[model samples]
Target: MSRPPRHDEATLLDAAVRLAAAGGPAAVTMSAVARESGAPNGSVYHRFPQRSALLAELWLRTLGEFHDACLPVFAEHAEPHLAAGAAARQVVAWSRAHRERAVVLLHGVEAFGRAEWPAAQLRRERQAARRVRQAVTGLAERLGAETPLDLDRVSLAVVGLPLAVVRRHLHAGTPLPGHAEELAERGAIDLLRGGGS
Candidate 1:
C-alpha cells in the first residue's frame, strides 16, 4: 500500500504561487494546485476553502519574503537616507532576479474579494503598507532639509519609484536598463532630500 500522503499549508501555498505566477490568478484552481502539489483537492480546500484565502496567504508570504530581502539594507546602513536608497535598489534587484514572481505580484489581478476571506488579510496588508511607507517617510525626514517636506507625497514617490521602473522593464520583456538601479537609487534620494525634484 502507498504511504499516506503528507502535505502542509506551506506546500499548498508554494504551489499556488507557482501556478499564479505561471498562468495568472485565474489559472489557480483547487484541482490544479492539488495536482501541482501532488496532494488531494480536499487538502487544498481544507487549508483554504476559497481561492481568495489561498491568494491572501500567498501574498502575505510574498510580502514577508520581500521585507526580509530589504532588511539587509537597513543592517548595512544605519543612516535613514542611505538605507532608504539601498532598500529601493535592493528591491529592484530582487524584482529582476525574480521576474515572474515580481510580475505576478506587481500587476496580477486579485481573484479573491474581501467578502471571500477573513478580514485579517486586509488588516495585514494595510499594516504592511504602513510600515513600508513609514520607512520611506523617515528617510525623507532625515535629509536635513530647510523646510518640512510633504510626507505623503514623498512616501508615494519612494514606494512608486522602484515599482514604476520595474513595471516598465517587465512590461517590455527587457532587462532593467543599465541605469535602472542608479536611477532608482537617485530617484529615492531626490524624493527624500531634493524637495520634490
Candidate 2:
C-alpha cells in the first residue's frame, strides 16, 4: 500500500494569506491556494469546501494574531486609560508591520456585505466587537470619568481607522507615516475627561 502525502492546514492557510495580501482578497481562491501551496485542488477542497471558508479562516487568524500582539500592552499597564493608549499605539504599530495582511483584514469588512458571509460568522464578529467596545467603555469609566461612548458608533469607527491608515499607504504604493494612536488616545482622553460635546 502507498502512503498518502502529508498535508498541513496551516501551510495551506499561509499560502492563501500570502495570495490575499499580495493582490487583495480576490487573489485567494482554491485554485490559487493550491497552486501557491503546491498542493492538489482536491487536497485544498478537502480542508475548506469553498473559497469563503478559507478566506474567513484567514481573516479570523490574522485578526486574532494582531489582537494577541496587543495583549501584552494591555497587561503591562495598570491604569485602564493609559493601557488603552498603549493598546492603540501597539495596534497602529502592528498595522504598520503587517500592512498587507492588515489591508486584507480591513477590506474584508467592506467586502462583507457583498460576500454574504456565514450568519454564524457575522454574529460572532458582532459579539467580538461588543467585547472590544465594552473594554473601551470600561477603561474610560475606570479612569474616573464617564463616557457618552456609543459602542456601536465608536466600535465601527475604531475598527475602520486601521483601514484608512492602511489604504493611504497601499494605494499610494509608498510609505505613509502618522501617529493615529496619539490622536485617538488624546481624543478619547479629552472626551472621557470632559464628556463628549
Candidate 3:
C-alpha cells in the first residue's frame, strides 16, 4: 500500500481557521494554509482545489459546528421560553469555547467568498441555512409568536441578542465576561417576554 498522507483535510481547514481568525478571510490563501499547517502546498491543493473551495469548506464547517452546539439546546428544553434562554446562553458558551471558529463565523460566508463557491458548497450552505430557519420557526411557534414582530422578537432572543454579546467582546479582543452567559440568557428571556415593558 502507498504511504498514508501526512496532513488531512481537517488539519488544513483548522490552519485556515487560525489564519482567518488572526488576519481575516483574506489571510487564508492556499499557501498560507500549507504554511500554517506544516503541510505541503500540494497537500493543500489536493484537499481544496482552489482558494474559494477552502474558504467555503472552512465557513461551512464552522457554521455546522455552531449549529451542532446550539440546536440541541433548543430541542432539549421542554418550555419554549426556557429553551430560548438556554439557546442564547449556549451561543455565548459556544463562542467562548471555540473562539477561533467564532471569529471565523463572525466574518461570515460572504467574506469567505461565498459568491465564488462551487455548486456543491452552495447547496450545503443552503441546507444549513434552512435548518436554522426551521429551528427558529419551530421555536417561535412554540413561544406563541403570532405576528411578524413577535417572530422577530423570538429571532432576536435566540440569535441576535446572544450574537451581539459575542460580537461585542470578540471585536474588542476581550475575554467574554464572566457574566456573558447570564447576560445572554437574561437578555433572551427579556426579549421573549416583551422586554418587561
- State each candidate's clash count: 0, 0, 0
lDDT of 3 by residue, 1-197 (tens): 99867799899999999999999999999999999999999999999999989999999999999999998898888888899999999999999999999999998789999999999999999999999999999999888778888878888899999999999789778999999999999999888876431
lDDT by residue for model 1 (1-197), tens: 98754878888878877887777777778889899999998999999888788878877777777776774574477676666678778878888877766766775335535455578888887787787766655555664433444665455445678888888877667888878777887888777666542
Badly placed stretches (over 4 Å) of model 3 are 1-4, 195-197
Count residue pairs with overlapping backbones in model 1: 0
Score each candidate by Cα lDDT. 0.72, 0.64, 0.92
lDDT string, candidate 2, 12-92, tens digits: 888877887777778888999999999999999998877767777777677677766754565567865556556656666
Error of 3 at 34 (Å): 0.6
Candidate 2 segments exceeding 4 Å error: 1-6, 110-115, 144-166, 176-197
Full candidate order by TM-score, most accurate first? 3, 1, 2
Among the numbered candidates, top TM-score falls to 3
Q: What is the lDDT of residue 78 in candidate 1?
A: 69
- Model 1 regions lying over 4 Å from their true place: 1-5, 71-75, 108-112, 144-149
Best model number under lDDT: 3
